[model samples]
Target: MQDEGIGSNEVHDIISAMDEHFNPRDLKVGQDVQMHFEPGADEGSYQLTDMRIELNPLKTLTVSRTDDGFKSNLEEKEVKEVIQAQKAVIKSSLYGSAAKAGIPKTVVSDAIKIYSQNVDFQRDVQSGDTLEVMYETHQTEDGYIAKTGNVLFAQLTLSGRKIPLYRYETADGSVDYYGRDGQSTKKTLMKTPIDGARMSSGFGMRRHPVLGYGKMHKGIDFAASTGTPIYAAGDGVVQRAGRFSSFGNYVRIRHRSDLDTAYAHMSRIASDVRPGTRVKQGQVIGYVGTTGRSTGPHLHYEIMVGGKQVNPRGVNLPVGQQLAGRDLKKFKAVVGEVDSQYAAKSGAAVKVAQRQVESQDDIN
Candidate 1:
C-alpha cells in the first residue's frame, strides 16, 4: 500500500515504495521531497497518498502507494545548449582582454593551456596581439548556464604569425589539439617551463655572482618571485629531488635515454616529487627560491644531453606527432569542419559589428 499520508498504517507499504527506485538514506540535504497525506476512515489513523523526489536537475523519481503496492516512475527534464564565439585584442594581458570580450574564465584558461605548448603567454603575448575563441556553453531552458563546454577551436595571432589549433580525437580514442597541417602542437619539451619569468642569465662563461670569479654557467637562470611554480620540462621520472650543498632545493628529471633537466633554488619541492616518481610535462615539481647559494630568488634551470649541459633555447627539440594514414584522413575532415565553423561564426560577428557601426552613423 502507498503511504501518501493516506489511511495506510502499514510500514511495509512505505518500505516497498522506496525500494523500487531510491534509498531514503541516500537523500541529500538540498533535494526536494514531497509527501501527500489524507485522513483515514478512523479519526486516529491517516493514509499515505503519494510522494515525489527530485533526483537532479534533469530527472525526478516519483512513487505512489496504491492498494496493490507502491508504483514508481521517473520524470525527465529539458535543457538548452548555447554556442558562443568571441575575439579580443591583447592590451595588458590575455586574461584581461578575454574578460573584457565577455569570454568566460574557464574557456580562457582552456585556450591558454592549448597554446602553452609553444607560446609563452608571459613573454610572447604583447599589446595589439589578437585572440579568437569558439566554444560552447550548456544552459538550462531558464537561461542559467549549467557549465562550459570544450574549446572547439582557438587562434592566436602574435607578431604577425597566426597560430591556429583545432581540437580533434584520433581513432584510437586519444584526443589532442593540432595545427592546421594536422601536426600536434605539443612538443617533446617546453621551451619556457615556468610562467611569468624572464631569462635573467643565459648559458655561457661568466663570472659567478656569488663565487665572484669567471666560471662556466651550465644552467640558465629565470628571475621570478619566490614561491612561483616550476614545471617539468617534459614527461619524465624524477632522478633527484632534495637539498644539495650549493644548489639548495634541487630537482632533476630524466626525460629520455640521453636527455635530462635540472631545477635549482626551489623554495620547496612538491611533496609527491621524488626519485622514480613519474611527472608529466607542465606538472608542477617545485617552487622558486634562493635556497642553496648566495643569490636572489630565481630558478637555475639546466638541460643535459648525454651527460653534458646544453642550451635549452639552442637545442632543436623534437616536434609533436604528425597525423598520418587513417589519422591524417580523419584529421583533414576535422580541419574542414573547424574551418567552416570558424568562418560562419566570424562572418556573423563581422555582420553584427557592421550593423552596429551603420546604426551609429545614422544616429550621428
Candidate 2:
C-alpha cells in the first residue's frame, strides 16, 4: 500500500483490514491485484474505494471502504463437480499415453498402482493397446480444474482381452477397486514388498554360504542397497520384532489363519512396528541391510503357510473381498453409471481431437 503512494495512516488501515482475511505478505508473483480509487474531498489526495486480489481461479480477496472503515471479504467463484472421460492408445507407455490424452499425472500414477496387482506395465502393456479412464474433478465455471478425485472406472485392452474395473464402496464402508466380476483388484500380499530390488536367491535347498553345507534356504533374498525401505506384504499384527540368532532385526506379521510373512536382515525397524502392533499392507516396516549371517546387503523375505516356509513366487495368494448378492447388484449399477458417462463424453472428446488436428493442419 505504501508503494502505491497511499497516505501512511490510510495504508495501515487498509492493510490491517486485508490481514483480517488474508496476509498480504503471502501473495505470490503473477497474482493480479487491482485497486480502484476515488478523489478524496481534497484535491491533493485519492481515496481507495475498492481493492481486489486474485487468490486463485476460484477464490478472490477483496477490500472496500465502508462507512465504519475498510472492510475485507473473500469471494468464491462458482465450481461444479464433473466426470471426465479420457482414452488413448498405448504407443509407448501407459503414463505417456495417458498424459497425452489429458489425464492428470497424479491420476495416471494412482490408476497404475491400483492395477499393478493384475497388470505388469513392462510385460502386459504393449503398443496398440488401449486405456480408458473416467474420473471426477471439481472445476471452475470456466472449466479450470480445481481438484481431482480417484479414477471411477478404468479399462485396459491388451491384445484381444479387455479388463475393466470400477471403484466401489462396500456395505462395511471399505473401498476398493473391483473387476466386472465383482472381484477385488488387491491381492492377499504384494508379490514384491520392496521397490527397485532384484531377487538374488530363490527359496529352495542350496549350499549354505555361512555353514558351508547343503541346507534349505527357507526364504527368498532380494538384493538391494542398504536402507532401501521394506514394506509389509499384507495387513497384519506384528507377531514378533527383534533379533533372533541368525535372523538379525527380524519382524514377522501374522496375516491370516496359518499365514505369516517375515522380514529379516533389516538395517532399521520402523519405530511404530512392534509385537502386537497392527500394520497395513504396503506400510514400511523396515529397511534392507546385511545385518544377519549374510554376505551382502539384501532383504530376507519369507512367507510361512501351515508352519512351513514356502516359495514366495510360487505361493497361491488369495484375492481380496468379493462383492456378492446385494453388494454385487450395487456395484454393477455403479459400473453402468460410469459406462453411460463415458459414452456420453465420447462425442465431446472426438470433437476436441478433431479441432486440434484441424488447427495443426492449418498451421502446417
Candidate 3:
C-alpha cells in the first residue's frame, strides 16, 4: 500500500482488519487481490478505502473502511453437489491409472483405504485389472470442481471377479460400505495398514538384509517413502509405545485378549498415540522410516496370537457387520440407487469419448 502512495496508517488499519478474519501468511502467489483508494486530505496522498482478496474458489475476504475504522468480513459462495463416475484399467499401479483417468488423488486414496481391509493392493491389484469409482464433488456455478466429497461406490475387477461396495447409512446414522449381500467391507483387520506401499519383504525364513544370515522373519516389511502415514490395523488399545531394541519408535496395540498388532521403524509416533490410548481402525499411529535395524524407509508390521508371531496373510480374519432385517433392506435400496447413478454417468462418459473420436476422424 505504501508503494501505491497510500498512507502507512491506512495500510496498517487495513491489515489489522484483515487479520481479524484471515491470516496474511495464507496469501498465496497469483491470488487475486483488489484494492480501492480515495483522495486523502493531503495534496498527493490517497486513502485505502476497500480491499477484497480471493481466499479460494468458494471464499472471499473483504475489508472496507467504516466509521468505526476498517471492518473485515468473509463471503462464501454456495456450490452444487455433483455425482460423477470414473473407470480405469490398471496399467501399472492404481494411482497411476487413476491419474490417467482424471480421478482426483484424494478420491483414489480414499478408495485404497476403503479396500485395504479386504484387498491387498500389492498382490491383488495387478495390470489389466479394472477399477470403477462413483464419487461426489462440489462444483462452482461455472462448473469448476471446488472440492471432492466422498466415495459413494467403488468396484474392483480382478481376474473377472467383481467386488463391489456401496456406501450406506444405517437407521442409527452409522455409515459404512456394504457389499451386495449387505455385509460390511470391513474385516477383523486391514490387510495393509499403509497406503501406496510395496511389500519389500514377507514373513518367512530369509537371509537378514543387515545381518547377512538366514533367520526367521517374524513380520512383513512394507517399503514406503519417509513420513508416509501408518494406520492401526484394527481398533485397539495401545499396550506399548516407545523406542525398543531393534524396533525403534514402535507401537504395539492389543486388539483382543490374545491378539496383538505391532508397528516398528516409525520416523515418529503420533503425539496422541501412547500406552493405554485407545485407537480406532484406520487411525494414524506413526510414519514410516528407517529408525531401527533397517536398510531403508519401511514399516515392519506383525500380528501376534498367544504372544507368538504369525504370518499376517495366513490369519483367517473374521467378517464384520452382517446386515440383516431392516438394515439389509435399506442397504439394498442404497446399492440400487448408487448403481443407477453410476450407470448414467458412465454412459454419458462413453458418449463424450465417442463424440471426441468422431470429431477427430472428421478433422483427419
Candidate 4:
C-alpha cells in the first residue's frame, strides 16, 4: 500500500474489510494483486477504488470502497471435472516415464502407493515395463487445471504380466483400489514405507558400515536425504516412539496378525505420534535421519512376525478385503468404463503424435 501511494487510513480500512472474508496473512508469494483507481479531486491524480487479490486459481478476494465503508467479498469460480489418461513405457524410472507422458506427479505418486502393496519399484520395476493411469482433474472455464483428483484406474505391466487395479467405493462408503478379480490392492503391509529412496542394504548378513565388521543385519536400510518423510508400513498402534541404542530416533508399530514394523534413524518423529497412539496406513510417523550410531542419513526398516525379524521383500503379506456379489458387480462396471475411457484417450493421443510427426516432416 505504501509503494502504491495509498493513504495509511485507507490501507487499514481496506485490510480490515478483506480480513472479514479472507486472512491477509495467508497470501502466498507471487500471488496476483490488482488495484483499480478512479479520478481524485485533484487534477491528474488517481485514487484507489477497488482491489482484487487472487487467492487461488478458483478463488478471488475483492474489496470495493462503498459509501458507507469498504466491503469485501470472496468470489469462487466453478470448475468441471475431466478425466484424463496416460500410458508410457518405463525406460528408467517411473517418475521419468510419467513425466514424459505429461502425468502429474501427484497422480504418479498415488499410483506408486497403490502398487507398493505388491510391486517393489526398486527391484520389480525394470526397463521395458509399461504404466497406464487414468485420473481426474478439475478445470476452470478457461480449461486450466485447478486441481488434480484421484487415480480412478492404474495398470502396471512387469515382465509381460499385467496387473490392473480400479478405484471403487463400496456400499459402506469405503474406497480402495481393487484388482480385476475384485481383490483389494492393499496388503497387510507396504513393501516400502518411503518413496524415492534407494535400498542401501538388505536384510541378512552384511558388513556394518559403522562397526566395520560383518554382522547379521536384521533390518533393510533405505538411504534417503535427511527430513524425508517416513510412512507407517500399515495401520497399527505405536509400540514405542523414542530414541534407542544404535537407533537415533525409532518408531515401532504393533500391527495385526502378530506383525510389527519398526522404523529407525529418524531425524524427528511426528509430534502427534506416541506410544499407544493408533496410526493409519501410509501415515507419516517420522522423518529420515541418522540419529544414533549411524554412518549417513538412512532409514533402517524392519518387519517382525511372531517376534522374529524377517525380510520385508520376501515376507508373504496377507491380502486385503475381497469384494464379492453386488460390490464386485459394481466394480466390474467401473472397470469397464475406465477401460473404455482410457482406450479413447489413448487413441486420441496417438493421433496427436502422428500429426506432430507429419508436421515435422513437412517442415523438413
Candidate number achieving the greatest lDDT relative to the actual structure: 4
TM-score of each: 0.68, 0.72, 0.79, 0.77
Candidate achieving the largest TM-score: 3
For residues 1-364, could you state the per-residue lDDT of candidate 1 as single tens digits?
Answer: 2423333445566666667777767888777878776777789776666778888776688877777877877776666677777898999977888899878888987787777778878778889999999888887775445678999899999988999998888888867788988888766577777876888999999999999999999989999999998988877899999998899999999988888999999999999999999987778999999999948999999999998999887885664678899999988898898788888887888898899999999999
From the highest TM-score down, the ranking of the candidates is 3, 4, 2, 1
Candidates in descending lDDT order: 4, 3, 2, 1
User: Tens-digit lDDT track for model 3 on 1-364?
Assistant: 6777766887788888888789888898788889898887789767778889989778899999888999999998888999889999999878889999888898999888888887888888779999899999998886668889989999999989999988888888867788899888776688789998888999999999999999999999999999999999988899999899899899999988898999999999999999999997788999999897989999999999989999999995653678899999878888888899899999998898999999999999
Q: Is candidate 2 or candidate 3 better by TM-score?
A: 3
Candidate 3 residue 50 C-alpha distance from true site, Å: 14
Residue 101, model 2, lDDT: 81
Local distance difference test, each candidate: 0.83, 0.85, 0.89, 0.90
Error of 3 at 260 (Å): 1.6
10 residues in a row with least lDDT, candidate 4: 312-321
Write the residue-wise lDDT of candidate 4 on 1-364 in tens digits. 7789988998889989998888888988788899999998899888888999988778889999888889999998989998888888999878988999888898998898888888889889889999998899998887677789999999999999999999999999978889988998776689899999999999999998878999999999999999999998877899999998888799999987688999999999999999999997778999999999899999999999988999998886774789999999998898888889889988988898999999999999
| Candidate 2 similarity to native, TM-score | 0.72
> Which of 1 and 3 is the better model by TM-score?
3
The list of candidate 1 runs beyond 4 A from truth reads: 1-83, 120-126, 136-150, 350-364
Off by over 4 Å in 4: 1-78, 358-364
Q: For residue 51, give model 1's deviation from the true position in Å.
A: 28
Judged by lDDT relative to the true structure, which candidate is superior, 1 or 4? 4
Off by over 4 Å in 2: 1-4, 29-31, 36-49, 65-69, 88-97, 194-232, 235-237, 241-251, 263-301, 307-311, 359-364
Candidate 3, superposed: residue stretches over 4 Å from native: 1-77
